[model samples]
Target chain A: MRVLGIDPGLTRCGVGVVEGSIGRPLSLVDVGVVRTSTELHVAHRLRELEVGLEEWLDRTRPDAVAVERVFSRSAVSTVMGTAQASGVAMLVAARRGLPVALHTPSEVKAAVTGNGRADKAQVGAMVARLLRLDAVPKPADAADSLALAICHVWRGGASDRIAAALEKQVAARTRGVRP
Target chain B: MRVLGIDPGLTRCGVGVVEGSIGRPLSLVDVGVVRTSTELHVAHRLRELEVGLEEWLDRTRPDAVAVERVFSRSAVSTVMGTAQASGVAMLVAARRGLPVALHTPSEVKAAVTGNGRADKAQVGAMVARLLRLDAVPKPADAADSLALAICHVWRGGASDRIAAALEKQVAARTRGVRP
Candidate 1:
């Protein structure tokens, strides 16, 4: 499955696309950051973000979108901007009928690395190694987005399997062939 | 000038329009709430809010828009939703080139009533009195929205006059005239 991951921020929003499924090698489709100028009004900044995300969605057309869940307790000053950017990201993806998944920063770290408390360098290194990239993506936000996409793909596999299993059981029950 | 004021919320977004200038009697154009189902995903809820705000802007065609400023420190559980909703409200207004104003809850109270620490009932009563309405609008959100619009009109008048004076000074300087 092709998944798009976003690390939402008002000043700099990171976006990346990863294509892979379980038991297969993951490949990086594309990655970049959407930056908005501080000089612009907050409303205009949000408008620019919306336009940028729409372009990304149109280009990649991912099966699912993964956004970093913003916690209000993290930073009092930036939490509102982060949350607003995330809301735009989710809205853009859902408008296209794509499944959107939210992963916490720790969750992304845990999925990409072995530990949830992994540092930024460790997470970047793991992402580079997993995607077979020559170097870690620049501007921590880019690497973080990739990690979120990878996490979604990996976790989404497990959930899809469970759903398929449930469907099979339901189908069998409808046929009076419960096993 | 006409202003549309919004009390941003996920479950019950308050919206109201007021038409009048400072030193003149204010009239209530409309007041209502836009609600989204809790069962819907966050993305869809945001989308619904965007649609609702767009409709309000289209129908009312207010000269300016006012949205309650959301503080991250307020109500940790619902702050994110408030920020997201406020973001959408601003975007809708800015996209149409309408000036957007943000008023804090305290500022709204101070503008409508004499004190910043006034309770909801006091603010509601003042809103009713200021707009010459028969009764306070139903739902605290509705009343709060009118209060915000009224606040914007009262405070926006001061800023607008200052802006006008600045423009006049610039024009006079260009004509080499001293005042």
Candidate 2:
């Protein structure tokens, strides 16, 4: 399965696509950051993010999406923006009938590096090794996004199935095909 | 001028529309809440909010949108959802080319009741009195939304003009109509 991972942020949202599943070799499809101008109004910046995310979705057509789960414990100034960006990413994926998973930073680190407290360099190194890339993705956000995708591929088993089942049930009910 | 005010939340988003200028008597155009089931996925809930806000915009066609500014100091469990909802509200308005303003809670209270620290009841009572309503709008969220709209009417002066000017410049640039 192919997964698009997003490290959501207001000014620079990191995005990476990984193609693989559990117990298989993972390959990197693409990695980049969607940047928005700080000078723009928050509303306009969000609109720009939506446009950028839509373009990525259209280009990659990933089967699922993985986004970093934001926590309120972060810096007060940045947590809100992170949450807003994450919400937009999830909305875009759900709109396309794709299952979206949220992975905590620690969860992603543990999945990729076997250490929940792994630092940025360790996570980046592991991602590079796993994806067979010669170098770690630039911009910590990019590497973190890849780690999120890898985590989802490794730990998405039950959650992914449940989401898929729920989607199908909802669709069936909407079509009046099920009671 | 007319303004649509939103009290952003995950489960119940309060919305209010008011018609009047800074000094003139304000009248309530509409008041209600947009609700999404807690059982629904966060992504779907956001999409539902988008649809609900769109409907309100289509019906009210307000000159501006006012949304409560989200702060991270609130309950950790709810602040993220609030920020996400606020983002969606701003996006809907911006997408429609409408000027959007964010009013802090204290600002709304001060504008409506002459006290920044006024309690909810005080703010609600003033909203009713100013709008000439027989009773405060039901649901605290509804009253808060109306208060926000009232605040924007009274204080949207310089900020409103700036937003309008910026929007025009952006639109002109988009159309290649400017040097």
Maximum-TM-score candidate:
2
lDDT of prediction 1: 0.81
In model 2, which residue pairs have backbone atoms overlapping below 3 Å? none
- Of the true interface contacts, the fraction found in model 1 is 0.40
lDDT of candidates 1 onward, in order: 0.81, 0.86
Best by lDDT: 2
Tell me the tens digit of each residue's lDDT in model 2 across A102-158: 899999999999999999999999999999999999999999999999999899878
| Residue A69, model 2, lDDT | 86
**Candidates' TM-scores?**
0.88, 0.94
- Model 2 clash count equals 0
lDDT of 1 by residue, B90-153 (tens): 7666555567777889999988898999999999999999989999998999999999999988
DockQ of each: 0.21, 0.38
Instruction: Quote fnat for model 2.
Output: 0.43
Model 2: per-residue lDDT, tens digit, B1-179?
Answer: 99999999989999999999966889999999999768777776777787778889988999999999999887668888888889889877876668888889999998888899999899989999999999999899999999999899888878888877766755543332110
Listed per candidate, the RMSD to the true structure in angstroms reads 9.5, 3.8
Poorest 10 consecutive residues by lDDT, candidate 1 chain A: A170-179
